[model samples]
Target: MKSSTAQYVMGIDFGSTTSKTVILDRAGNMVASAIAHKGSVSNDGAMVSMAEALQQAGITEADIARAVSTGYGRRMLDIADKSYTEITCHARGAVHLVPDARLVIDIGGQDSKVIAVDANGLVSQFAMNDRCAAGTGKFLEALARAVQVPLEEMGPMAMTAVEHLSISNMCATFAETEVVALLAEGKRKHDVLGAVHAAIASRTLGLIARVGKREPVVMTGGVAKNVAAVHHLEQVLGMKLRIPPDPQIAGALGAALFALDEITSPDHADEEDRVDTEMAAARCGTPTCTAKKPLPANVHPLHGPALH
Candidate 1:
C-alpha cells in the first residue's frame, strides 16, 4: 500500500441486512458511497460496499486517513479506526442531512430507533426496538410475502386502500398469521397493506413518545425508501418528514463525518486510542480472531489488517 499522508477517509455502516460505505475528502465532501445487501451481518457485505465506494472514488484503500464504523457489525471491521453505536452515528448523520432536524426516526431491516438530537448533533435521548422484528423492514418483508405481494409494490398498492384495517399483534409471526386471517375474511390486499404500514407507524409513534416529539424530524435507513412507510409515518405524526437524498447511507455518512473529525479536530484525535482499547477488550485470542480478521482478497482495507 502506498501512503503519503492520506487525503481521504471512509466510514462504514455494517447493518443487519445491508452494509453501506462512504468516502470523504479532507474537506468532508462525500466523494462516493455504496450499499450492499447481505443475508445477515456478513463481512462480505461490508467488503463489497467498501470496495465499491473506493472504486467509485478512484482511490486505493491507502488513500484513506481514517475509518470509523457503526451498525450491527461495526466492531467486525478490522480497518475501522473507531466504532460508535448506531444512535450516535444516526443522530449525527440525520442532523447533517437536515441541519434543523431535532428528531431522527430510523427504521432499518431488523430494528427501529427514534433519537432526540441537540443542535450540536448529540443524542439527548433515544428509544430503540431491537428486541423484536416488529415495525421493521423484516416485518414488512414477511407480511408482503404472506400477502403474495411484491415488497417493492406493497407501498404503491397500499396507497390505494379504501378502508382502514388493523393487525393487532406486534410480533412478525403473529402479524403474518393475522394478515392471512384478514385475507381469509375477504379483506382487499390494498387495505391489508395499509394496515401493515399503519401498524409500523403506530409502533414508531410509541418510540417517538419516549423521546418526545420534535420538529423537522428526519427519517433515515432503508425503510425510508418505502413510500407507504413514509406516508403512514407522516400521517401519524401529522407532519412531513425530512428525508435525505440517499436515506440508506445516513449512518455511513455520519461515520464518515466522525472519521473526518478525528483527523481535523485535536479534540477527537484520541478517538483512535479509545477504539483500539475497545477492540482489544473484544478481541478473541484464537488464531481466527473474528474482530481482526482480514477482508477477502478482492477487497482492500483502508488500514490495519492486510487483505489476503
Candidate 2:
C-alpha cells in the first residue's frame, strides 16, 4: 500500500549577504523558494522570517516535516531541525543537481570554497579562503565600480577585452590602486576589467589546486555566472568549469535536497546515506515528490552530524 505520509521539507541558507529558503517535496523537487535581500536575520527574528518565507511558498508552519539550516548564520536558527556547514550543504547540493560533478567551487559574496567529491557524491576533501574578500563576489562588485560600470554589466563587458592587462595585487586595497593606475594609463575599460577578473580567477584557481584538480569542475555561488570571471578561470586552469543555471541558488537547492533525503530514509541518518540516496534517485531518473506532513510546534530542531 502507498504510504499516506506527506513529506515536505524546508532548507534555509542564511548567507552573510542574503537569506534564501527552499521548499521541496519528498521527491527532491523544488516547490517554492523565497530570497530575502538583507543579511542573515538576528537570532530572535530567524523563525519569524523563516515562517514568512515558507508562507511565500504556500507552505504552512505545520507542513515542514524537517528543516535544515545552513550558511554563516546557521547556528542562530534555533528552530531548525538540524544545522549543517555550508561546505557540506554545497557539496550535497551540487551533486544533487549534477551527479557527475566531481569538483565544486562555490564563490559566495564574502567567501570561496573548493570541494572535491568522489563518484558517490561524498565530499573527499575541501579548502576555503573565507578570510578575504579578494576572491569573492565582493571583489567583482568593487572592480565593477572601479571601472564605472553597473555590476550586472561587468561580466559581458569584461568578455570584450581583446588584450589581457595584468593586476599586480590580490589584496582588495592594493587591487583598487592597481585599477586606478590602469585607468590613468589610458588602458581600455574592458582590458582593466578583464585584468581584474584574471586576478580573482588566479586566486580561486590556487584554492582549487589546494583541493587537487578534478573534473568536471562545477562552479557554484553568485560569481560563477560572471562570463569574464568564468572565462578567465577556464584559461588559468586550462580546464572547463561547469556553471549551473542560477548558481546563487545551489546552496539552498542542496539544503532542500538534503531535507528530502532525510524524510525518505528515517533510519539511515548518516550523511553518506543521504548523499547515496540523492545520487541513486538522480541516476534512476525518478521523479521527486512534494508530499509532506505538517511539523509539530514542539518538535525539537534536527541536529547535523557530529563534527569530527
Candidate 3:
C-alpha cells in the first residue's frame, strides 16, 4: 500500500443535513476540508452536491487520486472510487482522531450511532439508532424553536440552568409540546433547556449502554459540539466523554483514509485503467452506466447510505 504521505485522496460525507469534503495526503494529514449546508442526498442528489463541495475546497476532479464516499448518500455517488457504510467510516474516523478510543458516539442530524473500536483502530462492534430522531440534530432544532432560541445557542443556554426541569416526552413533537407547556407554567428558559438536554442525554446513554460503556468514550458528529449535551451525557454515563476538535468532520476524514488505501492498493492501477476506459467511453457519447439514485425522503434504511 502506498503511504498516505505520497498521495492525495479525497473523502466526501453526504450527511442528512449537510455535506462535507476533505482532502488528505498519504499520511492522513488533512490538506483541506469544507462543510456545506444541504439536505441529505436521500432527499436530494448527494453525488452532485458532493461534487460542489469538493469544488468549493478547490479540489479538482483530477486532483483526487481515489475517492471514498460515506453517509446517507454514499451509494448514490456513482463517481466515488469506493463506498463505505457510515458506521464503518465513523469508527475509522473516530479511532484515527482518538487512537485510544474504545467507544464512539456520533449524533448526526437524523440518527445516532455507537461504535466500539479495538487497539488497531478497527471496529469491533457497533449499534445505531436510525429509526428514531429523538436525540438527533432535528430534535435539538425543534427544541430550540420551541424555546425561541437559535439552534446554535442551545448548548450555552442549557449550561445556564439553575434547576433541572423534567421532560416526560421522548418523541420530538411531544417534547416540543412539553417545552411549550413548561414555558406556559413560567419555567425558566435555562431550566427548560437543561431538561431538554437531559432528555437527549438519557436517550443517547441508553444506546451507549447497549454497547457497554468503555473508557475514553469519544463523541463525534454535530451534536458533540453541544457542551451541555456532552456534560449531561458524561453525568449519565459516569464517564468523561472526549470530543474531537472537529467532530463533524470525522466521517470525511475516515473517507480520506479509505481513499489513500484504494490508491496504494496493488489492484488500484488496474482499477484506474478500467475507470479511465469507462470515462472515455462516456465522453465519447456511449450510454454510460448510472450510479444509484438517492433514497426517497420517507425511506429510513437501517444502515447508512452507500459511498459514491
Clashes of each: 0, 14, 10
- Candidate topping lDDT: 1
| Global fold similarity of model 2 (TM-score) | 0.82
lDDT of 2 by residue, 198-275 (tens): 998999888988989989999988788889889989998898888888677778777777777677876666565467
Against the hidden reference, what TM-scores do the models get?
0.88, 0.82, 0.81
lDDT of each: 0.87, 0.77, 0.78
In model 1, the clashing pairs are none
Query: What tens-digit string does per-residue lDDT give for candidate 1 at 1-308?
Result: 43327999899999999999999999989999999996699899999999999999999998988888999998888778678888889988888889989999999988999999887768999999968889998999899899999988999999899998999646888999999999999999999999999899999999999999998899999889999999999999999998999999999999999888877883565555556545654665656554545457675543343312
Among all windows of 10 consecutive residues in model 2, the one with the lowest summed lDDT is 299-308
Candidate number achieving the greatest TM-score relative to the actual structure: 1
**Superior by TM-score: candidate 2 or candidate 3:** 2
What tens digits encode model 3's per-residue C-alpha lDDT throughout 1-308?
22224357878888888777778866667877777776655524354545665566565665666778899877666557667888888888888889899999999988889998887888888888757789888899888989999988889989999976889536888899999999999999999999999999988878887888887899999999999999999999888898999999899888878777665663854565466555644654345534344656765322122211
For each candidate in turn, give its C-alpha RMSD to the true structure in angstroms.
Answer: 4.5, 9.2, 8.1
Q: How close is candidate 1 to the true structure, as a TM-score?
A: 0.88
Q: lDDT (0-100) at residue 121 of candidate 2?
A: 93
